[model samples]
Target chain A: MGLPPKRGDLILYSVLAVIFLASCAASGLLLFTARGGSDLVLEAVLDGKVVESVDMKSLKDESTIEIRAGGGINVLAAGPGGVKMISADCRGGDCLRMPAIDSNGDVIVCLPHRLIVRVRSRGPAKASPIDSMTY
Target chain B: MNEESSRGTMIRGPRKIGMIAVLSIVGVIGIFLIDTMDGARTVTRDGVAMNTVVSVTLVSAKPKPQLNAILDEIFALIGELDKKFSMWNEDSPLSEINRNAGISPSAADGDLYSVLETARRVAMLTDGAYDPTIGSVTRIWRDGTGEGRLPSSEDIASALPLVGCEGLKLTSGGEAYLERRGANIDLGGIAKGYALWSIRRLLREKGVGSALVNMGGDILAVGDGDGDRPWRIGIQSPSKDRGTPLCAVRAANTSIVTAGVYERRWEMEGREWTHIYDPSTGFPIEGDLLSATVISADPAEGDALSTAFMVIGPARSLDLLRILPGVDAIFVLDSDERGMEVLATPGVRDSLEMFDDEYRLTFVDVY
Candidate 1:
């Protein structure tokens, strides 16, 4: 007959299995969440060639728009918290990633996109997605 | 490497127990890796090239460093094919042969051999429904520097004598000869599809778990989309803007080739003409179909089949459909007395997820 394991041995195996399974589960969850992120490059240009581009596929979907910029260029959008970028020309990769602007009345300028970012905010009285779709 | 298991089960010997636990963990982890590696990535050989893609699952789990590399190789193979086969490429071997008409060509590689082989095969299957030797006839009605005008009956008659598939002789040494001085081979109908086929092979070799290669509308899906979802590719509705897709279908390692009059055509003598010509009369065929699409295992076959549909027109296309064993087709035509109709093979209808319009497939020989 195989030798019986001590209580300590049993406890050790139980702990290891818990650790192994937890790590696996955590990693899988992170992967599933990350996969939903989109990676798309949106380029706005006046000519056939690209004037400026922003990579915003990963940001959360917003109902209101956000816009940002530094100089001659600007971006504009509306709805649930839209996002835009600020400043560029291959200067700092800034016009590329810029930052998230959530409030209304904030203006963003980019010398590169030839764009002006305009944001419009909605009050809490606004309907949610379910109500809007039904109406 | 020491055999720690030699010792009897030790009581409170912390180091000994720790060793057993560590070894067990390592062994189990090893088992997991060995079990999963085969499903991780796959590579394939396409014609003379190789393509590799990590498992579709890995595309998310790991970096896809070689995906673009695989696509680049596919493009390279197609470019090579184009250099060899394009009638437009004056430097091609086939062009050289065309320039030296009435002489047997020396055996050679590149586009010349491919063109000859494809022409011979298409002739037998389509019963000369598709022929590469219609070059002279096509030129009589072609508008190069000026508007395209109808060739006189005499000119057409002169060109017709040089245009039959039965009129050319292909020797085993890769030589093609025209029974008459004026005949030439034009693989325009089939070259793009062949290029797509080569590209498909390149993708297959790269272990690309799944891929979709689109050259203006000739598309091939190398495998199922990365995961369980089929790759949903849209077919452009005719006469619409490029961004507007009429419909979509899921592809699982299949090719779709579409031939249309609108893709490339010319106007001459205040009249419009297309490159798809009828060898019997040597002129652009008037038909119900504005376009025809075919599904096949490879691009070249799909391309040639799509051309056959275009050549056969609506009625003959339907008849050809009945003659074909398992192939399918989709035909779009003008819907009014204005000369528009949409037609598709019965087999194609079975695979159709959705379509809008009164479409039918009938067997007739309009050509």
Candidate 2:
């Protein structure tokens, strides 16, 4: 049989329980509210190399730019809504098939010619670093 | 009896104090673990090298300055690799090899030799479907694309004899030679993959536990993303105006590479030509496959196999992939109904999630 707990022991246990709960609440709040910043930057990468980065805020005019790598060429259009591949000489037309990317972490990839266009948040948008990217 | 109980209480006092101390230490460690696990930060760095934007994202406990310095070193290494491997640069080792074609075996640097050895091994494995010796043919297509004209049959025929990988010989001592006078070697198909593998090794050596090295579309993933989640990779759609992924796969510590016919293409005489050449025909491979994406532990294997699969088309490539161990693939083939047929190996099929309902997905069992 065990002896009855003392008042001092009860107070210490209660203090630790409260602290644990408080930390849990704090971490929960931090995790939920972490993805707040929304500033987006569009990046154009050809064959794994970044060629151009355009701020979404500065895209006042729709512009078409041609990116040529080896024998492949991709024509990209940047506008107020988002950036997209307008046309490409590659036979698959995969880049042209990709939707316009406006939000962070959305990407359009042309695998044959190794072109990638992606939208990324200007600031530290999320906690995890990039672990992998699909072309 | 009262005096005896008092003496016993005195003895228990120090034992009680020791128990309390141990509990406090446990509590503190618990708190520390929670804080460190929740506080993991992701640092990202990007730079232009190898004619593409190279980006590295790492999850680290280190300060930003230290992380940035490591990234700077990686970028510098990539730049040096680009200088060494780029065929366009006249001073590059690869260009020198091309310039010295048929004359003598050029002594290759460690990096060059490693890439060439991998390329040669892959060439042999794929039965020359993925030849690095197609430089002569690639040059013709590059010049043709620049001029917006197709290479004539005469030109293609002349380059055909020069397109065989058998013409290039590499010694175990890091020397490379082209056996034929007109034969040229291009590492374009496999160079980026080799660079990514090297970068991943460098990061590992630098004590980085997790990272992603994406050179264009050739990707090497090291560890889990933030929050212990597997990395999500989206496969590009081959259809028209279908923005959103055809599919996505979750991966960690793997390399993903895609070779498609959609990126580099030129129109000549009302026909479209891509950069990938068939060594046997000395022309761009024509088939239903729009792109081939391969996943493997080795980045160079993923890179070389992606190109080889693109050349061999879907059916033959799937056959090849079935017999090959440690690799899986997804082939996006052009369909008659304006959509695509997504064929994947069982391993790849398990992780793939189809985002678009319009496309067809077929799972193949090659085992």
Candidate 3:
């Protein structure tokens, strides 16, 4: 039979086993608790006013909505999976380049046009509070 | 050989137990750290009040029901404040004082009395540039704007005599009276700021560590933002084309109040008329400045100062801001040569971040 494991070897193995299990548990919690539901609504606000809200859950087909305000226009697309700004007249193009928002509280802001597109829960899904509002 | 084996076995048993205990402690610590780093929670509620959209954001780990209850109380408090301060409310305390103008001193509530006192002091400091006794002029302008017309000069002149704050008398026992007939008081300029202070006080009393209150455009930050970051506030551009921010400021436990010509304006007969009026002339103040933002430890002061600065114009307002302690201001002006110019006090300059290249930033010396 092979030589018995030494004290140093046992200690190293025990520490490694603890770390592995801890990491696994952390990842599990993140995966299960952090994922948001698919039912989401997107609110388009212009000049601190809500102009329109499109429900992603109710949409059966992909469509685009154009908002014209303050001498600028922004086009937003809402699909079954998510919503995104497809086009805008502003110079920065930051809103257009923003990634698709699938979860609640994700915001796409066009500073030049003063337009904000934010995703929210459709039903009574738990709302995560924001720390502060800049406007 | 047997003795050696027994000694090794004894060492192994205790060592294994010690190892398990250490591992359990590590696991517990790791879990806590993960939860703390990733589980920071925030809740936001939005509603309409004071003829504007008000949003309250709170950072808490409390249950949803508890958080909802706190927000409900806040909203209800705002409603009550509206009833007390609104000039539109015929039964409001302010209306009662207005109706009893030049007749008798109306017994005011404790809060209303304090707010009026503060307004009187600010009006004196600004030399009537931020008078609360301009209710008659404001009423005419409101009606004119609603009808897409400008108030006639004769009407404005008639209202001017009653626009001075000196005509309003306040007693030591919370009694208020207007010394002149037709003189009225409108708290539109200062009421929002007072409401913000009230909200902050309520949140503090309720053990809320972090909160942001935004009533219309007036903002009050009570504590640190998420992850200890300062709250970032975007200053709206005065240009009508909207989307681009003129600048931004980071605030913590302070109030920011902005008075912009764009907030309330109407176009009639090829001219633009804003709602802000000069207490002296009883007409909208004419200036190149597009907006004035005031930052102060006191929200009420910030609110009143913003209107005062807007009325005082850029040069005189900058002078007044220098002498005022614990207050800062930013002025966005329409320059004839340059496209636009941003003049700010030292404190305001430090926190202001200008995003556009076309706009020039100038720092004014307080001393």
Candidate 4:
């Protein structure tokens, strides 16, 4: 039917398949990785002054909060296994993109906005989503 | 004969209706895509953007603003807008525009006209207290680097001649011109307020109930959050003392702006070189306390007035405030010797719930 349903369809299918394969491998790799947990403190500073700080070890599941300074803001998130930025006002969202930190010694930072996402476990960190998965 | 022909042609009503419905749905989707992709773009403000928890964007509303992203956007917009529209940026189209002045209309886009007009109006109302065309004065006393030094009396005097509201002109047809070559209208004095006005227009058109534009100390409050309780905005204490708040102001439908010497200044030769300049003398204001807060129906106007009062000083600020209507101010004069003496309009004092004995809160009410 009209040149066997167009060559474009075949190309789309192939591209999608490649993406699926890559994502599966990556997710598997992440899940299977070892989980390292520790205690971490995130301090948001402005003009070399610490405006706000949050201790991740004390948090159980998730905590969403906002802090404001002269011309900037720092957002924090703390979760059960580990803590990471769900969002921030900083220019680059690198802090948010720092992988799910299940370990205590991980630090996710946004330098431009003076933000830090630090993770530390009181005991030992559990296996992360990436750590648990295997290819 | 026409009736008979029409009667015979009248057929497939359901099919026509079905086709029309499909077309309508497709048209709606097309309009949505076009507007979302291009009509509404993510625009940031230039200069020192605020780290704000203000959840004001209607399109991206959750709760407790995602801080860093808004700051970045604000910062980027200011930078981008500056690069695009700076009259002094020599490399900018706006510089070419300023060069042309009376020769061209500065583009039909109207941003130049809007910013210039807003600046001029604010300058006039403040009686030279807040003059936008004081860039030359600010440039002379440049104090960022190692060689940062305050300009001499002659330097200020020369620039003072070039500084005034008279040098900025906006024609009736949305065309703006720099009346003088050295004269410049820095939106820095009025940009936040312009943004507040534009955002308010967008919100009203979209039927949004409440919004807050927090450009650091410059904040514009519109309506209510969740349709209940006024927005409790905190005025940062200009005190060097840590972990203490000056006071909080509650607003349902108004904009509040504060201009402080502590905001951005480099002390040189026992004098503070700040961005806010006094057109009368073409110099940074010397003051007692920390900041001057302006509350008004127009946020942009409020912003301009705040800077004007900061430059004029408190004693002279009283004379200037009286002639102005629907505008009030709170001057926190650093009473370092006598402590902090707050000179506020009756309205501004009423808003603060004073706590602790040492820190006094006052209100300035302008109806």
Best by TM-score: 2
Give the distance in Å from residue B56's predicted Cα in candidate 4 to where it truly belongs. 4.3
Give DockQ per model, in order. 0.05, 0.21, 0.12, 0.04
Q: Give the residue spans of candidate 4 off by over 4 A.
A: A1-55, A58-135, B1-93, B101-105, B143-147, B226-228, B240-243, B336-338, B361-367
lDDT of 2 by residue, A19-83 (tens): 66776666556554544556788887754456878787776657776788547888878766677
DockQ of 3: 0.12
Q: Residue by residue across A73-125, what tens digits does model 4's lDDT show?
A: 65666666455667667654555655555444344555556444444343334
Tens digit per residue, CA lDDT, model 3, B1-367:
5998777666875676577767776876776666555544666776667766577888776665777788888888888888999887899999999999988999889779888988999999999999999999999888876677788998888888888888989998889999988888999999989989889889988888777888877998888665457777777778633324678888888998999887656568898788788888888878788899888988988898899998989888978877887788888888687568988888866677887666789998886
Across B28-117, the per-residue lDDT of candidate 2 in tens digits comes to 567656554555567776555676656688877766577878888888888888888887789998888888898988889999999988
TM-score order, best first, reads 2, 3, 1, 4
True contacts kept of each: 0.01, 0.32, 0.10, 0.00
- Candidate 1 at residue A107, lDDT? 30
lDDT of 1 at B63: 31
lDDT of 1 by residue, A30-134 (tens): 444533333343433321223444544434454222333324334333224446543244333434453454433223334333343323222221221110000
Worst 10 residues of 4 chain B by lDDT: B39-48
RMSD of each: 11.9, 7.9, 8.7, 14.7
Between 1 and 2, whose TM-score is larger?
A: 2
Which CAPRI tier for candidate 3? Answer: incorrect
Ranking by DockQ: 2, 3, 1, 4
**Clash count, one per candidate:** 37, 14, 9, 54
Distance from true location, Cα of B327 in model 2, Å: 0.6
